[model samples]
Target: MARKPGALRNGAPFRDWVLPAAMEKVRKRLKTVDDGDRQMVTILGCVPGDGITAVEAACQEALD
Candidate 1:
């Protein structure tokens, strides 16, 4: 299968404290998710009109 351009290996950007923090956020969101609802997660890279760091942080927080 082909990989997404913005995708990083093993979520390297979110390291150390950031990783744990992100995981907690994702877990909390997951708890409230509706049953049978497909979760769509995307990690945005350094692109125009997007912050690579911020997007990574958000995705890490929501899906990483």
Candidate 2:
């Protein structure tokens, strides 16, 4: 995703992957900005170390 961020929008692998609700909301919002795909991918990359739950919570908090 870092190398090919557009894949997150059209890639087969991502199409089947279900994101947490908050993350999904963030993704939708990100889609509206320039280089949003790359930004989203950067956020997604944090999951490995931060964990999805933490990321999701942070996304929700940010939304709030």
Candidate 3:
């Protein structure tokens, strides 16, 4: 996902990975930006270390 952010949209590996509501919302919003894919991938990459809950909270904070 970090290397090929575009795959996050239709990649088989991420087919079953459901994002948190806020994260998903942020992701959809990011899709509109020119480098959104890369930006989202960077955010997603933080999940392994920061955890989904933390990332989700951050996404929510960002949205707010």
* Per-model CA lDDT versus the true structure: 0.40, 0.93, 0.89
Give the Å shift of residue 61 in candidate 2.
Answer: 1.1
Give stretches of model 2 more than 4 Å off: none
- Across 21-52, the per-residue lDDT of candidate 3 in tens digits comes to 99999988998998898998999889999999
Q: What ranges in model 3 sit over 4 Å off? A: none
Q: Model 2 Cα displacement at 16 (Å)? A: 2.6
| Residue range 1-64, candidate 1, lDDT tens digits | 0243222223455323333455346534654665211231332223235664575566575463
User: What's the TM for model 1?
Assistant: 0.27
The model with the greater lDDT, 1 or 2, is 2
lDDT of 3 at 32: 96
What overall lDDT, based on C-alpha atoms, would model 1 receive against the true structure?
0.40
TM-scores of all predicted structures: 0.27, 0.93, 0.85
Could you give candidate 2's per-residue lDDT for residues 3-64 as a string of tens digits? 98999999998897899999999999999999999989988999999999999999999899
Number of the candidate with higher TM-score, 1 or 3? 3
Estimate the overall C-alpha local distance difference test score of candidate 2.
0.93
